[model samples]
Target: MAAKGQEFFEEQRDQSLVKAHIVSKYFDAWSNVMLGVRKQYGRIDKLAYIDLFCGPGRYTDGSKSTPIMVLEHAIKNPELASLLVTMFNDKDEANISSLREAVGALGGVGSLKHAPQIHCSEVDRDAEEMFAKTNLCPTFSFVDPFGYKGLSSRFIHAMVKDWGCDCVFFFNYGRINAGITNSYVERHMDALFGRERAEKMRGFVRTMNPRQREIYILEELAGALKDLGARFVLPFRFKRGDGHRTSHALIFVTKDFRGYAIMKDIMARESSTEDEGVPSFAYSPAEADTPLLFSLSQPLSALKGDLLKSYAGRTLTMLQIYEDHNVDKPYIAKNYKAALNELEEQGQIVANKPAAKRPMKNGQRTFSDATLVKFPALEK
Candidate 1:
């Protein structure tokens, strides 16, 4: 293990806390969704959570890590404790040992039907190949490597191949942003983005500015995952503590749109700021009032315009419009609701509510998924 790895656990930094919160919270919600499906449909019998580079259970500052939080969540939910299986692995023996001790110290470890499995193995080609060949339970894998050595599209594709399987991996943007141009790290970069795309990106990014480079790189990565049958890739950015630049991001990948939508809402809640009701989708220490040189803002006015133009003369439920438009979109359902409500109020569109009043939220009328919206046709 490198000194950087050691320094990471010395104290849980602010970014680390955000990262942990995003992962654990997603896992909790994911479990509940899966559990509900199992109870209603009985299509799934087990759900698995695998952490490829799980670290020691606690930071030197005594803050619990994701593994411990995961266990705690499962232990508290009797339904989840019975069906959720966990596997945690780290190349470092010391981390595995510390994790074992930490897991043992948890309050309800004994309640779990299946004990958490711990493994000490390097996450290299062998691990990737093993996962690709084996059939995994509906699994959620978290891959957090020290750098980008063991993380690859092949491994990620394998992790999300099975039904209900999804993955969240750490994208080391700082290292990658530098590595794209450096000849030394070319092999790892190729493995991540595929050989041809990586070579193409290296040349493509040369003429681009910093912001353009970031967007292009992420789009390329998302494209690669989509090509390999893993659709619905979402990234959550983490800025350096100084807020000068982005350090890394957590990329969520899955084949299902429901998983994608669930994660999007979760990420939106954790975002640092919103512009005109649209989330920034980043974590930065800079004050919310600070002016930015570049910002990606999707105002409600723009959304309303888009909806009117795109769905002119068509009658569709709010859910249908959101489902069709939300892919690769920064706007969440709330933004959609706000825009739709404004359009209805202004007589730009007709919103038909259910005959029976739907449940009121915050004691105010709002558009439910079933609300029928009709947009006026474009001017002839």
Candidate 2:
């Protein structure tokens, strides 16, 4: 199975539009974090990029992999041109050779400003051990495994325990669903969720259908990540081309709200572009075949209602609203502005700020802590 997986990847290196989209989103998120860190810290002494399942440099179609993408971004962006350390690990020596060749073709690390250190190792190292040897510099690690063998809650806990370290990992939902009933896979399940939780989950979802089972497992994984100290966990679902079932989920775990907000924005933008108005966070392949009245405005309207209902007859500053709702599930500060605008249009809320007669959108009006927002009086 492993050999076939590698062969398939090599053969279709340039194929899989789904993978292309996923990788593009990954690159976007990674770039955002790098730039954000630089902007936040002024000048980071060192930044680390680690890819556990680093593939060959280019796909068959000549597209760059994650490592190449990282290097290109660092070279292009002045802020990220500072001291950088990148480690690419893969079990296959051929993949390491290909990645080295690809880096060399791109002019190698010497082409960068700081002469970034690049490490390509063909070893079986897990996240826990890799993180143990890592320096105190801020690190972003990408964990994309073929299955859930080496990934454990304990390892994830250790990775995020350090300040300024975040992770993006691929969770194979299909594989888990398929192997849920197999006794031989029990050990892996135990390692993934911890033995006690795994047994409890197995018993809980034993009678669920495949879809239900997958959802339960995903929820459990997200919960485990939270328990392990990830302040923000966002799961981006990827579906097969047919849009019948999910193939896998890209889970982003971070310790900072800014990182969470950045990823949320990226996922929303990418999914909306691909799904045509349906945000990736709210998309389901099973419902893809059936059409419903879903539009870009629907989310805004819903947000407006939710905010009004939650804070009726109360006043809050724009910052307060964002702080309360930005980190909430299915909604971010980006969604709050539109909802607030819509509420003002309907007289459901009033914005009390200088020259704020009209609803604010984007740069038209800036939200501040002193800006008062009063919801309409609740009926007696």
Candidate 3:
């Protein structure tokens, strides 16, 4: 039998499909944004997409994976055709061979300015060292290791240190949860969370229930990334097919809040449920049993209270509030607008458009990015 995770290459699964779509979609949007920048500034000439554990280009079920999806999208866009640089790596020689064949057979591969770079090398500490020394262009790197062996904070940091660089890695949370206290995987855990933090995490999670443990670990990982200068970090959880437990997650790391905002919107759209317009940022299969509905109101209510308290006595435009408050939060721009609108209706806050501007939607005055909002201070 094939090793774990290799089976998915044989036949794509639902979670894999979701993950691939999210990555490809983000790349499409991100590249377009970069293209716009290039046109305006004439400085950004090349964009790169690196996939460290890219599988065979096509699954046994005849479905294209992320590498092909990204290339296909780029091929269609003339600007991306000249500006994009693609790279794919897999340690398995067989997989590499298969990907080479599939890519060679692509309809428009010949039109790309830079041919895709394919490599078969084990990604580990040496690879991390190489990345640290290399100068990367504005790049989006995807690191999707089978378990946790080839993934490290240092490696991810190196990939995103340059300007306009961002990373998304497959976080095998289930393996990590079990491996935390396992002596055999201790070194790997140390590499991922750093030695000091990993040691503390092991003891801290001893008493935490599974839900609490999951939250704590993810927060710690995000903290670690932040400590390494990744200003924004977000996670999209993927639950097991049974919808009972988390199998893994895709964590995005970036220095730019704009990238963070773009990814936030993408993940929000992919989320299985949006409770009160607030996305759960997770994907799980629908369960057979009827689910509870009362808790949905809590998110908007909490957001309203949080915004009122956080911005008390301050007046700022809707865009300003979103840019200032959206880092590391799951509430997208719409959720913020909804919360602010409700606050205005309840007389808890004041939202107004500029005198010189009138923004309307469907013949109704609308709260736009330029709309000014003022929150009254809390009572003493």
Candidate 4:
């Protein structure tokens, strides 16, 4: 039995169920590059696409087909087929069945010497073992899932370690808003953050709207992903003027600076289109700009602190920290000093170096992140 027409359209409209963006412009930006890799390689066999939470192949209306359409378009260019392979997985057995049927329908084409190898599965119970079995070095993967539970940081770690591919994941801010703040999520906080971090103790996820809660939770999530080894991540919001909206992110995790540059281009184009009703972004800001009374409610500076914390354990020049972590030299100095001063008062992060003055090119000056030692708290 299939879903009714209206039922299908409703699901297609909201990405919380079926991926709406994939049938939209993000689909174009992602697939064009993927297919181009195949064409450029000329049957060289160096690329693959893994849709981690692929839904059933087509909506009832037939307008919102994704992975199948992507494959159809790529196969048109015979050169691409020789080099590309696609894999799709879903926890739902029905969707997995639909995907295989869809792939089978798109059989041989003229001069399309190679057919894509698509493995449709009901959720990956053990992704690491599957990674080892496939032995495919991927060029790209589409990891758009409905919520946090669909994918795990553990599976993500394996992909980074074993496959070494560029990954695009759906952040689903809605889930973070509705689910993360709930105590139910707290029980599994170790999966979200890590063990050492979880050991630090707290009732962290207080209920909040997506925007309100993200102030702390998302910053930590970014830190966790970094701890899992990811870079060149840009958080993107696709604003559909309909007032009904969804929040998601596209990330590329790779060690090479080249991959970082390509991801920048992809995010810039994806985020900056007229269709999404937003301007394209061209950068990861090097400074958290806080204008007092300007953004009084949700200041970017609040996030600025976590940005600083993420940079801990690394020696950075003022310029380097600004460039790498997105905070101005003045704010870093003031806040860094304020944090240590407060900690010294309450005993949290002990400052190894007392307030000291150093000579600068302009004049005598003070520095905050001058590599201070930790002071252990003494019992009275």
Candidate 5:
């Protein structure tokens, strides 16, 4: 599975794919912390970087793995090397070897003063132990699991229950939903959604067939992150068709609001500057002129749909959408359309329309209906 993403990474290194967004997002967050360290901390308090499913460098077109690039950049700060540590882990032995070689090629051991540890092990096992052993230090972990799914509620709980830990997990909604909305999750749901979510999700999509799995998985995931007490989360997706696609949740969960602020800051910094005639958030509208969607092996339309409705529940206008989320607008629009269509298809909305104010310049509000809203307010 890890190899597959690597392959995809190599294939889409220069194109608009998941790898680009993934790397950019990480660097944004890492650099933000670096700024904080310089301005406030004045000295990083043992700054630490952890990649749960960190793969090796050079995916397809020599594009760098996020963790490795982040490590390289972080240590470049004079204070970072002396105070920070990098722990990059993967379950694949080959990937681990590649990571080691990558670090070595760049000059290992002596190259980095923080003594970054690159290990080969399941992140769940290693993350827990590492957390228990380390003292309070700013941490950033990338839980990029395979397309099916990755990590668990316990994983989020253990790392985040403490206020200092901040994690960004890749929720492969399409792949997981194909199974989750079905009977595949019957056994280990508790592991995935934290009991409460598992049970609620099971009930929500019980009558749904395999096709509805994506929605169920996405809802369950957002619910799980909420369970872990996340302030806010925005998804990242890669679409293949109008309704069929692959999507993942780049969920940010943290106990502190600063973390939420930090995520928002990072997303805005990393999204496309190009005008794709759509909003720039990961889920921006088509007119936003932004495109960052990528592909994986997951079928996540339903999950993406659920998340879009989640957005409609709170957001009102393009400005509000931009303020509340940091993902590109095209991505937001994708999620928005999925959820809106789902809501409408289910007869949840009878007269849903955009709430328009008087346009002094142009009274084209008659056809100005690209804004999102849910009639009858489905799924409060």
Candidate 6:
């Protein structure tokens, strides 16, 4: 039973490069995290996956949807095949039926080396209620709702309060921006943000330009997630074909720094085109015909100047640098070391170890927690 106006399992929906890129990254991240977690935990008894808005298992073009992707990844890998459980929910019963058919067409989990437990249910209740009833396991939940109505702050707090649970949700920016001005939607917004913060954001959006408004709203969303105990909240934006206004943002929330690092790397790699040096993605169909413009310079090159300026008069260790600036960004210690070397070559810094005769470049040096670095005085 689909909703009155809702159509289930549409045969024809445009799949753009941007959508492909996003989906590809999602699959890659899922597989990588699954393997990494398995390795880190060393043979856990149960691993779970929950998809709140799981559509039909395949697109019209026979491309796999997220649930299908997860199933395929898990079934194909020997280590991930055992004791795996996947729970899929859809508001539309027809969509759930279609997914079942699709999964059956793939020979189902029975064809795999280890059959996984699969559960499909048509959920008429809110997202929070569905999540509350879910059994606690090491879970990766995908909450990609078409709109922003059902996701509340309290729901998010509950989701990430556990140790091994993580979530990737769709933040429909266009929908939010459109409905936010209305008085009726303000209450819903209050559920998303707190009442006081929602009122403040409403007043603030009134004076901002479109770009500023988007940035502010996203920042607020990120802040809300952080307050809810998510250690890392990374957003990947998607835009309409026109290349101006953003359609939605995919927000990944996790409690582990390692998962955060993996997602950042996946996004940076997926978004970028051919050149590893140039990282850029065109979110719009209008720019699909055009080559990917290298809008920003290489991150390492840019970070060198910032590093030199920050450490002009101070001595710091690699751990200190990593802690200070490398937490949220796509950069790691290796990138930081590259930046340090660039500064050292330009006479802006010195890599010093006890009784070392000469300053060493990052490649020639091995940095430990006790390694010391000195930034020379700026030229007068």
Model 6 lDDT, full chain set? 0.66
Residue pairs in candidate 6 whose N, alpha carbon or C atoms collide under 3 angstroms: none
Those runs of model 6 whose alpha carbons end farther than 4 Å from true positions after fitting are 1-43, 111-135, 272-282, 286-302, 312-320, 330-338, 352-373, 377-380
| Candidate 1 vs 6: which has more lDDT | 1
lDDT rank, highest first?
Answer: 3, 1, 2, 6, 5, 4
Which candidate gets the maximum TM-score versus the true structure? 3
TM-score of each: 0.91, 0.81, 0.92, 0.57, 0.63, 0.79
On lDDT, the candidate that comes out on top is 3
Question: For residues 1-380, could you state the per-residue lDDT of candidate 4 as single tens digits?
Answer: 54677544443364332234433344444445555665676443555666777777776555435677667766765555665566677777777677677777775633345454445554444664675355556546667666666465555555655433666576666565565436677544566567555444234544444455554555666667778776544454433323234344444455444455445444444332221122233111111122121223332334334544565444444334434443211122333433434444454443444434333333323444554535333334
The digit string of per-residue lDDT tens for model 6 on 1-380 reads: 65533321221143233444455465556656666867787755666777777877676567677777777766676566665677787776677787887777664467454443345543333657756666566777777667866677667656666667777777888888876677878877887777877888888899999999988998888887888778788877765545576777777788887677666666655552323243333244444445455333566766777777777778989778866876556565566765665566676676775324535554354456556789766678
Ten-residue stretch with the least lDDT total in model 1: 287-296
Better of 1 and 2 by lDDT: 1
Candidate 5 residue 333 C-alpha distance from true site, Å: 17
Worst 10 residues of 2 by lDDT: 271-280
| Candidate 4 local Cα displacement, residue 52, angstroms | 2.5
Q: Which candidate do you rate higher for TM-score, 4 or 5?
A: 5
Q: What clash pairs does model 3 have? A: none
What is the overall TM-score of model 4 with all chains considered together?
Answer: 0.57
lDDT of each: 0.86, 0.67, 0.87, 0.50, 0.56, 0.66
lDDT, residue 352, candidate 6: 72
After superposing candidate 2, which stretches have Cα over 4 Å from the reference? 1-43, 113-127, 130-135, 272-278, 282-299, 354-356, 359-371, 377-380
- In the order shown, the candidates' Cα RMSDs to the true structure are 3.8, 5.0, 3.5, 12.1, 9.8, 6.0
**In candidate 5, what are the lDDT values of residues 1-380, reduced to their tens digit?**
45867755533342234444554565556556656756775654566677778877656446567766776665565655666677787889998887777777664346567676878876555665656565556676667787534467666656655545677777666666655546756545567777666767767776776446655566567667776676555554443223244454566667665556556545544443323222233432231243334233232354444445656445354334433543322343333344444444566542235323424223222212245443334454
